[model samples]
Target: MYDLIIIGAGASGLISAIVASSSGEKVLLIEKMSQAGRKLRITGKGRCNLTNTLPLKEFLKHCGSEPRFLYPAFNLFFSKELINFFEQLGLKTVEERGGRIFPQSGKAQDVFLALINEIEDSSCQVLKDTQVTSLMIENNRIVGVKAQSRTKGNKEYLAKKVILAAGGESYPLTGSQGDGIRLAKAAGHNIIPTLPSLVGLKLKDYNQERIHPSIVGFGVRNVKATISLESGKKIAEEFGELTFRENGVEGPIIITLSRQIARLLSQGERLFLNIDFKTALSEQELDEKLLSELNIRGKEDLRSVLRAFLPHELIYLAIYQTALDPRKKASFVTSQERKEILAFLKHCQFEIIGDFGYEQAIVTQGGVDLKEINPKTLESKLIKGLHFAGEVMDLDADTGGFNLQIAFSTGYLAAQNAEKED
Candidate 1:
């Protein structure tokens, strides 16, 4: 019998298998796909953001909820440890903006291949094209897993311990098809309501060509975006790039707000996002600047003059929405019109009808509740020898490589504790 069996060969599974095997445990890693790290290969547009170089406390802050829940994992295997681990595997890393660490080679495949090579060198057995059908439990403890191999139709393997690192239900094409959630539910673990996090927002307006030309691919930098809930309470506030999509808003800023927006939407609340395009400029500063520009170019059209401060598409959109003639001179613009212009620039609003769904989400917001798992060991409180790691757990963070760090940290903690217990 193997010492440890890891289900799913994604980032977390790969790390856990490597750690467990290096500790002298006979580890068996199973994957449903023909190859491993399908999702990892596509992350960061193939660059594979491994982890962030931020401090442990700062990294935990990116996690929206249950910051304390990650204390044990972060303390055990932080980002520095991860960098060291990759370096030991011959994969050099580089830090980019926001402390995001990517491979020096700039290839996600290199990262995956490096991890796979380490797993192989450690004498770990990797079984591909194998789909786990069910968990084999005895006396409230997991005994082994029953899976069907593509080569040998209905066969099963038994092990002493099992780690469920199967990813959350996002990017199904990458093999994250909610199978782990199904397994957790079968094993009597509480599965939290899952929603798409770090996904784009879908708007009501279908004026595709107009929206695409004006907003799509255009990123508003250093902007503060606030999601105004139906109750008039603002839920989330973020400052970053706001990428306008053909349907709605996207990019790091919008994706960060998408989780809260999606949760509010589930409660029958409609969303309205306000974008402060000039977040660095106060109202007084913006007003004064506008007055100066208007005074200097009194004969110039207000719409044409505002293009210096905003994108041409945005200026045109503002003019169209305010029903102002683009050809009107700045001198003819009334104070009320200027106020409207300021409001549009400061509070660029968009009605968020819904999220873009899991297909585009970077992570699943909710998963197996954390309370049911021992944070130190990452093992289920209700089950023995059955552990969880990575996105399958409730822990998730905002963008900038924090989520991947969570996966690596928790996976290491789980494998380490499991090996110790063995």
Candidate 2:
């Protein structure tokens, strides 16, 4: 018998094990993957974005759905505490652009190494390649878990408490395949319909056909993007760098907006993406600049002059949209052509068919609802001795380390409450 059985050895599960074991609780950390923290190692493109240095209020705004639900846990373990905790663990960290925090070593492997090494030193029993099938609840009270492993086959492990920190259903290659959501649902927890977020949105293929073949990976920096449904209802607008994908768009702003758009799309909403290629200038201002460029370079080919405004490949799309002849001299360009160019630059629109889906999504948008879990302890209100943590709890935040912070904070809270006096 163990004091606590923590399912899924990802960020939350690992943190739960550390906190519980350090509190002198007998712990058994189970992971279905052959290696623990597989997702952690590949996060932030292998740099391991830990947490942001943003103030609590500002930070909460980046989180999805109910930000209020995190108040209790963040109050207990916010970014400052996270930094100090990692520091105490002998992993030095650095704050980068946008207050994003990462290990000073600049290697995600180092962070994972530090965490798993700390786990190995603790009295907690580690079980890798072990699949936890279901909870062994009796009479509405918590008991143990039924699990199976290739070496041990099927077995039941009884525990005084259990922490479901199995993460969300994103990056299935890393072992986050919605096992936790299924377990939560089986235990009678309400699940918010899951969707892929922080992924690429598939734009209408017509936009690609208009552009040159070389434009597939073209990047447009510092642009404003507006999202709206086919009904002409505006969904959102944001400004950030974006890269043109073969099928659609991806980048910081696009990925962030993809969360809400995905949910809206699942409800049968058709959408459109409009990018302001020249966000720094208004339509009038851009017109003046375009005319000024034409006056100075009158003999240059219209396409050649456009190179000053856009990338070599993007110029083809601009020319196509503006209906301007590439061979035409800047001096020969008509006023109507200039007007078309202005509109195209300011309002480049594309139909949003769908997103790149879960495999490409950086995080899962929804999971087990938060109303069913205790805000302070992360314990499931429906079942005693059953706690929830991390992405499994219908909580996910934008990029820049917010989601990982949620995992760590909730894991700490769950472990803190689950521990019993020896």
Candidate 3:
């Protein structure tokens, strides 16, 4: 029998094994995939944003469901400890914009290898291609786990403790297929139904005017995006480059707000995105410049005058939407026509009908409810010697390095507390 049986060889499971086995505790890590860290290898487009360098309070705000649930874990093994752990393991790291940390070599595979190497060096046994079917429990206490191996058939292994770090429902190909939630439910843990977050929103295709082949890849810089309910209540707003897809919106800002609107949009509340193309100028200031330009350049075609403010494809829509003739000389343009153009630039809008779903979502927004787990130790309040970490524990955060750090910190704490019982 082993001292710890950690399920899933992703970020959390690997860290848990590394920490627990450091004292030479007998640890077994099980993974369904042949390779460890399948998902971790592809994070941050392979650069792997390992952790955010945000101060504790600021960093916690990026999380959802409950940010405070991670306070105890962070207090024990915050970002500094995490970075130091990797640095000691021989993976040199560097920090980028917004305090995001990554490997200096800029390869996620390198970071993944360093963790695997640490696990190997710790003498922890790793069982690859072994899928955990269920947690073995007796009298609401941890026993071990049953598994099905591709090469070795059915088997049951008993351990003094079990740490489930199987992750959430996002990136199914990476082995996060919601198995953790099912395992938690079977063990009597309440699960908050999962939803897609940090994903692109697909707008209604009714008018079909918002997107066309020419506009599909268009990107605007330094724009302010505002989300409002159909009832005209402001929800959230972000400012950055917004990229338009044939389906809808994406980019740093759009993905960041996706989490806030996912629930409301799914509930059938009509939500709209209002973009300000000229954030640098007040509406009055922009209008005055437009009027002055029209007065000075009125002899030119309206399409030509519009070139001073917009791209050709965007002006094409402006021409169609406002019923303004492209061939009309600026001098002949009506004041009402100018107002329409001004409104379109300052308040371009689209309806957010749906998201790209889990297939494209960066992370799942829900999992085992945090209330059932002990915050300090990450142990289950219902089951002795049972622990949780990472995306499987109803903890997710905005895109940055916050989520990865949560996984590392919780994993470290779970293993420490799990073995401390021994």
Which digits, one per residue and each the tens of the lDDT, describe model 1 over residues 94-137?
Answer: 99988999999999999999999988888899999999989999
How displaced is residue 291 in candidate 3, in Å?
Answer: 1.7
* Candidate 2 lDDT score relative to the true structure: 0.89
Tens-place lDDT per residue, model 3, 6-108, is 9999999999999999988999999999889999999999999999999998998888868888889999999899899999999999999999999999999
Candidate 2 residue-wise lDDT, 125-230, digit = tens: 9999999999989888679999999999999999989999998989999999999999999999999999888999997755676676777787888999999877
TM-score of 1: 0.93
Candidate 3 CA-lDDT value: 0.89
* Candidate 1: residue 182 Cα off by (Å): 1.1
Q: Candidate 1 at residue 358, lDDT?
A: 88
TM-score each candidate: 0.93, 0.95, 0.95
Residue 150's C-alpha lDDT in candidate 3?
Answer: 73
lDDT of 1: 0.86
Error of 3 at 345 (Å): 0.9
Clashes of each: 0, 0, 0
